[model samples]
Target: MIKLTKLAVLCSLIALPTQALARDVNDLGVDVQAATSAYIVKNTNPRYPGSYNGSRLEGWALMSYVVDTQGKAKDIEVIMASDTRGSEENAEKYLTNLEFAPATKEGKTVEGGYLFSFEVGKYFNGYSNDKASRGFINEYDEINKLLQAKEFKKAELALAELYKDHTKNTSEQALFAWLKSQYYYHQQQWFGFDEQLSVAYLLRAKLPTDIQYLVAKSALQWYSFKGDFNLAYNAIYALDNIEGKEFSEENKLATIKQIDDLLARTPQINSQINVSKDKLSYLSLSRGSIKIEGASDVSKLQIRCADQVVDLEASELVNYVIDEQSRRCGLLVKSANPAEIKVKQTGYAIVNSKFDAS
Candidate 1:
């Protein structure tokens, strides 16, 4: 799940009412989606050893970045590492040479911050026996490279090959799903939305509870890519519901509140939907306060727009949509002390358009 601060939401609110923030270093970009993308590139790419002539081995780096008002990354910390010895040192060395444009709001850079963790380098697993698996994994490595290089087609092809042949184990399946999700996200493609959702579900369902937080985070990414706001919410809920006996109560509450606040303030508004386009576009209403309760695993919620109600299963993210128009739909939700809704189904519920407000 994404961690947000009261100050961030407050900044988002102030930016919305007084003036529409330009896509500057302060506003954090659309739905915080673009912010995540930009942050991943900033933190991860530096971990890989630049090529001198030999192919680079693939691996993932888990690092946290503190993005300041200038949209520049500062004080990056390594939470975990997949790099061999000295990779962290090398990453730090590379990061020092980097600069970023801080996030801006209302034409001025606000001192807001965001953190991100991403895998860097090629995802190489030392040794394997099956040639098909090896080829597929290599292709997967190539796909990661394409992502790193901003190459989509070749990476997509490589992903297709992996999904088609080598994903039999849980880890392999997880890798395939993550790669596919990232690919579609980069191209703004939704061709495999449902498939990716299913893949995320399958992966999460099989993971142990201890690791559910990580799974929930990954599921949130899948839901966001698939444009399933409800699913994304449910994913956060799942994260919130975890027994935090091992953590301080203050930290647990803080974590849950951050997730809740994000959902409450950031409304996913449909800006454009074309039946022929195969993808959905939305303008995040990321500036209001729509209060929502923290969930406990399998909570249910219903969403209403216009006059229709759609049922969705709540976890951290819920998946629901309005399909009356099928092709195009304009949506908005009023957060002026909205009413609590009940969900009938186990996924997301789409409400009627009349329920939407500007």
Candidate 2:
């Protein structure tokens, strides 16, 4: 598979209108806020998830329209669009003769220019690639609309369908991977660790060198999230080897700093797979004291402390310790939300609290 470099990520995400339609921001006669509802409709089908050359190619287009007092579209413009000049000219021709119900402001008909951004794309909905020529952006919008209308299952079904089918085109595929990874990560799907790693590794392979840093960064993110310091460190070092030759010293240092931060918090992380953990949980002034409970049978527990809920995590347990020089320490223990404590065979008791008591 061709490694789709991240450099073209933005391009891949957006469908280029056949022609460029951006204008000087000053030429937008009205403030963006005022033209909220105004839009110029087009006759062409917005490409979304569907068979183009007999294979699904996911895409979408966005355009803005200036409306007149007569409820007529005075101008049709593509915003942040990519396409040929001929397509743009055709879009303009379609807009010039377009009709719209005039708008009213302060009880009077007023020439109002509004920007309308319309999109259509594929969704996870059971709609197959053969059914819709678009992908995620369109599907996402429709699902959102349904959700906004309070149709949750319908929206979910759309997503389910998209996931089942077009889970390959970089866009559609990425969405599925993201949702699955998040689900497994949150559930601490330790069994799926290698699969998750494979996806991150694959993404790293696909992204271009210019944006390979992002891939490496993502890998580090998974490593840290999984509390696998060793793996995270290895990934960081590997990235350093690959990127060191090309990136400036300052850039490399910045990346290293991020990795260092991740490493600094390793000790507080639970080594056992069955434990539910909170490195930092929030509290309010209305409550004092926290209770800690075990997520499962464990012999150790830990929590990082802070002056406030500013920075809390299971790892870096010492951070919760009150500084001797400080007169008052923020409260760490709470009543209803006591940090449920737990421990593994290591016999660690970790809990973090911030206090500022005089």
TM-score, each model?
0.33, 0.29
Q: What's the lDDT of the predicted structure labeled candidate 2? A: 0.36
lDDT digits (tens) for residues 23-74 of candidate 2: 1112122223433223334324333323345434332223334456665664
Model 1 C-alpha lDDT per residue in residues 1-358, reported as the tens digit of each score: 1111110010111111111111112222223432221222233232333442332322222233344554455544442333234445544544444455553344454333322222223223574211224655687777888998997777767776666566543445445665676677677665453344334443343234555455566665655553444445445445555564144557545544554554444344332211111111112222121222322232223332211223344443334444332111112121222222222122222321111110
Best by lDDT: 1
**Candidate 1: segments with Cα more than 4 A from true spot:** 1-136, 169-171, 190-198, 205-215, 221-230, 237-252, 262-358
Backbone clash count, each prediction separately: 50, 66
Tell me the lDDT of model 1 at 267. Answer: 47
lDDT of each: 0.37, 0.36
- Local error of candidate 2 at residue 264 (angstroms): 5.3
Stretches off by above 4 angstroms in model 2 are 1-133, 140-155, 169-172, 179-201, 207-219, 234-248, 261-269, 274-358
